[model samples]
Target: MLMTLLMIIFAVMVTALALTLVLLISGVHTFSTSFSPLSVSLASTLFGLGVGLLMFGGALLLFLISFEICKLIVKLITPSIR
Candidate 1:
């Protein structure tokens, strides 16, 4: 189904992006610089990913709630419409 395909694609893309970020962080040389880009990138990426996931969860929850409300209304109105 389209939903399953979309989910699979999203999972793959997220995984790829996270892996790329980690790899880039690892590739940086820490000995030459007082400030490590690795740590900064890791922290920022973690925060960003966490916020994104939270937002996604909130949106999904809202969607499900709205869907259930719509379903309930449809059920309540069906008999009258008939």
Candidate 2:
């Protein structure tokens, strides 16, 4: 269940990032731009989404790295438990 939930969250994060990046690359400005209100709004939304997903990506990396470390530790200890 936890893994499923994580997978769903990961999928959503990746989707949002991809969408925002596409818009940005296509020159649709986001909110933070020093330009017209409409373009700034679009750019801002895309930029915000991009930043948020990047932070979330960091969290995902941390989780995966920790999981690997824990698995390694468990394997190291399991031999003596026999």
Candidate 3:
């Protein structure tokens, strides 16, 4: 059935998902490696970029808050109704 096919597809892409996880978890950014694109860096950088912009205009700086940034990024990327 359709559900089984979707599951198979998901299983096939597990390695890719794993690679993404490795990059996210270890913060291993190889700018000189196979991928040297801004988009790729953006995904990782956004997570690494702490300090959120408030509802009002102001800026705050954070020094090394990778986990927070990562969670913020997931919120940004998760789909919403369009």
Can you write out model 2's per-residue Cα lDDT over 1-82, one digit (the tens) per residue? 5466456556655665565456444343322343545545766666766765565555556556655655665576567568
lDDT per residue (tens digit) for residues 56-75 in model 3: 11211121233355455446
Q: What is the C-alpha lDDT profile of model 1 across 1-82, one tens digit per residue?
A: 5456446555655655565455444333222232436546766656655555554555455555555655565576567657
Off by over 4 Å in 2: 1-39
Which numbered prediction scores highest in lDDT against the true structure? 2
Instruction: List lDDT for all candidates, in order.
Output: 0.52, 0.55, 0.40
Q: Give the TM-score of candidate 3.
A: 0.24
| Order of candidate numbers by TM-score, starting with the best | 1, 2, 3
lDDT of 2 at 20: 49
What is the number of backbone collisions in each predicted candidate, taken in the order shown?
Answer: 0, 8, 0
Better of 2 and 3 by TM-score: 2
Off by over 4 Å in 1: 1-41
Regions of model 3 farther than 4 Å from truth: 23-82
Task: Give TM per candidate.
Answer: 0.47, 0.46, 0.24
Q: Of the candidates shown, which would achieve the greatest TM-score relative to the real structure?
A: 1
lDDT over C-alpha atoms for residue 29 of model 3: 36
